[model samples]
Target: MPGAHGGSQLPLFSLTIMESVLDAIHARYAPVDARVAEILENIRRDCRALERESRNQGNERQVEEFIDRLRAEFGERVVIERQRLSAWAVRTTRWNYLFTVRGDSTDRIVLVAHYDTWRGPGADDNTTGEEIVKQYLLADLRAARRPALTHTYFLAGSEECGLVGLSSQLLLALGLQAANLALTQQNWLWAVVAAALAPLAGYRFGVSGSREYVKTLSTEQLRRIRGVVSVDSVGEGRLYIPRGTLGADFLHALIPFGDYDSINDLLEEAAHLHGIKYNNYLAGGTTDHVSFLEVNNGLWVRGREAARRVAARLARRPYTPPLRVPATALVAMLPGKASPLVFGGKIHTPRDTPDRVYPGPLRETLLILDYFFHRLDGGARVGEPRNLDEFHYARLYRTAAGHLLALKDAVEPNRRNVNGVYRATATVEGKRGIATVRDLVGWGVETRLRDQVAEICAQLGLTWERERIDELEVIGDDARLHFARHLTPFQRLAKASHRAIAAVQSVVRNWIFLTFFALAWVLAQVFGWALDVAFSLSTPFALWVAEHTVLTLIAVVAVEIAILLYMMARRIPTWIDNAYRHENRADNLGSLRRVRDQTLR
Candidate 1:
């Protein structure tokens, strides 16, 4: 097994696949998840409904109707928060909406998309994403029997005029966590006139359209979070991102891309009907994912990875911490395209409507939705899901590779030589199809090669970083680690007893703290209040006493070091005999055992 519990090897409750189930909820996919289509129609209907309300024909009637309809459909899941903006067409202009579906989890992941537009339906700019998310949410909600998470949101608004409501929503979300305080208080602090600019400065940068978005997402947090996946400005066309080659042998993708099995997975499918290429775009900025990198430094460490280990330790019926280290390992950007089928066969425009949005991306979106469900059902651990020795453990080791790659890229921007690896300038080969030191070791395997690897490591002075002759399997868990298996039964018993004794000794640790506290109190009283009372005036006397004491202590340490070095230099026989008084080490313990054995003989 790669990355699973050893018990049955196959995880309990098998992975959950809720894609079709969700599609059914929205009535989108035909014959099964027809709800998908239904969900799309609803998006268009909602947009038109909002437009009608804005037209002043219905006035407040339309606004109230819209909210009531949403509450009726979504039930208690949707919550509303009101705000007043200084600049508005009318007083107390309600400018925003945040829809949500909670799950049964402690941590929250925010996935935001806007739905508002200045005019013409504003479909492709966001209508596409809005529909996709709505369908996804409807599908997720249909299966209410499954667990639900809280505090996550689906935010939609018209970004054409300005970010407006979205900014406040984000600030509230991040502020609560960043300042280790309530979201309301943190916002008040951030919005206050006297608060320094530095604490929440990350909002000013990101891939978003805002100039001062820090009130929303902080740059420091973005840098510190585990990972981010973005989807933006996609329609009929294939998804594309430009990632230069890491090495000649490495693939075009610098890291894992989406939930697809392979590039060919995207190249073929119902999407094939539309003829899209989900290829790398190389260098272009359309959506807001760049903001994640632009602000919030970069959450390089893994969050999912840590959570997985923790959840595994809990193992449900009653939760418990795992015996392993945990951290986040993967972050991604998921930018979706607009509907291939919409009004007038266009997207991201008022003309972009439910009639023309394609089914392909929707299907893909459903599949991703299924991935989230499956991850939750089986416990969302980092890396490929499998048994103990299989994928999971391998990822634990590969997680280190992320940090290494980051370091390598930073140090070798020109793809020059890495720390110990041969660079473009240093690599040499006299013939084509020839192997150099760069080739994979096991394939060109030999004892001599391993010896050479060790030799090269020693030469480079990075044996630890490069490789060691010792098999890593020795450190592998699910078996023995650190200690050898060859010890006799008696030795094992004795060693176990020794460890038990040490564990028992640990119970009295508080005694050390109590002793230190008692001594400190005694010194404070003797040299503090009593002396002050005796002197009747303390300032000059206390200062003078400390100076002499501090200087004398430093002088005593200097004298001791000097005397020790002098004895060593002269090779003098000092009276001191340095020996470790241990029962298990090579000296007294061995002697005692030998003596006992001889006496028995």
Candidate 2:
């Protein structure tokens, strides 16, 4: 999964799921003599505890307790590491631990899960994620067969605070956890990140703010990454991920873990292959992986909402050809296939707890992610997501469940074929957005209006003919589909005017300049002013008003003139010159008039 690296669609955990993980780990403990929360109560009872344990340090006791509890639950399989940071905040020190099933190979892949949650008891946000990772760790040790890729494992504390523990101590602790100098010395550390931030590499990435969870391709250093798969809420409550988009290409299979859990959910699997079942994780909050996506230099896949925006604008079709839909909508649909689910609900209230989650169809989500990540990491090479039959087909497709029996093999999120219409076609299809295939076809058809835009550009004496947009126009049958071509000249003019307005409005009506205008108005109101300076007579009140108003107006104009002079310093003509020329051209055109009378008929 995505972790602090770029060149990926998703950045892993750039925000706040840390607290949730911590909360889950916290709940797993009874603190020896002190009963979990009771211990916290005791600690809080003491002022020294508050002083010595202030948020970070106090969390350490909780961390230690969690390590002990995990040890009890998973036995010697859990490796806990504690670091005392005396140099930083007063009593604050970070404790990070790595949990690996004994006999786990360094040659195998790594499962990176941060055990830190933010603020309070974050159950859905990440307690579930933390629990899944910890359970996976234990299950990894107890399982009769270790996963193909298992390079030890890890957990972090204080992830809520910029992933400092994960970034620093965890790397060292993994070595100590494995008890092998070579394990941490020269091993490839690949990961399957749960939570919103998935691993990044291909088109499927992460998103911020929205549930889609994509990362900037430009955010991380990509030398160490192998592959990534994340789960997030595809906007509009749909779930998706970008797999085979050529602009952001990907392998075509999701791993199959028979049972679903957060740890395995990101890899994408339709059914139980290898005892792993896909389960949908009830998610809330962000993940630590976001900081790691598109690790080099890239942006997230365009969002569905953004695509919808372009689609809405296309529906308007106010002259400018709405031919860009195919590309624009496709770009926006880039991140969903890999994301988990999202809901529009108020947060932090008591109503949000495990009891609120109903167990329905989440198994595929867990199965898919785990399978995708492992396979991408090397459980399987980049190819079609196959079933037990090796039939190379997708079984767990998104249909109204049980409705599909035969044709479910084709929609592997990564198998797209745009052979004809446009060689480079983008598709923005999500759960809800993908409801209509006809809509997609229509979008592709409407995208052909580039011809009109090219024509308009040519008429304007612009150098746009050789451009790609100029070379292509989506051609379709006019009988049933007549798309509007070319933007109206008035719209073109309004756009031009708006552009000019944005660029020059600052100077034209700046508050500082407007202050001068206001002063002019004040003078006019108080003493009476005239717009025409030459026509003013010698009435005392009018003379005073005119003098002050003109003086203020002149000063404002002079400032603008100074700004123009500054801009002209670069040897380019000032925009003021253009503004003046436009006005002059309008005046010249206005001066010539031919009056013609026509009959009403």
The candidate that achieves the highest lDDT relative to the unseen native structure: 1
Global lDDT scores for all candidate models: 0.32, 0.30
Q: Estimate the overall C-alpha local distance difference test score of candidate 2.
A: 0.30
lDDT of 2 at 494: 57
The alpha-carbon lDDT assigned to residue 104 of candidate 2 equals: 36
Candidate 2 lDDT tens digits, 1-601: 2111101222112122243432232333222123222322322332233244344445456546667777777666545544332222111124445544433333333344443333333333333334444444555556566555443343444334234322332443343334333343543332212111222212221111111112212212132233323222211121222221111111111111111122222232222222221112211123323323322212223244456668878898533321110000000111111122213231222222343222211222333334443443344322222221211111111221111111111122222100011111212232111111111111110111233223333444433221111011121122111111234577557546654643562243212223333544465454323435433554675566566987866765576555543333211222322332343222222111112212222
lDDT string, candidate 1, 1-601, tens digits: 2111101111121222233433433232233235445645655676576565552222234335656776788787655532222243121123334444555653333344444443345444455555555554555556545344443333322233334333533554464344433344655654443233223333321123321222354444332322222333332332332221111000111121122122112122212212222333222122323323323122232345456657877876444422211111111112222322322333334564444444444434443434443433333322211111111100001111210100011111111111112211111122111111222111101112223234334454433232211111211124221111234677667656654543432321213223323444454455455656744676776677567877855664465545543442222211111111111222111111110101111
- List runs of model 1 lying over 4 Å from the truth: 1-35, 47-66, 73-78, 82-94, 146-151, 161-235, 240-277, 282-285, 288-295, 298-355, 376-601
Pick by TM-score: which candidate is best?
1
Error of 1 at 518 (Å): 71
* Each candidate structure's count of clashing pairs: 87, 104
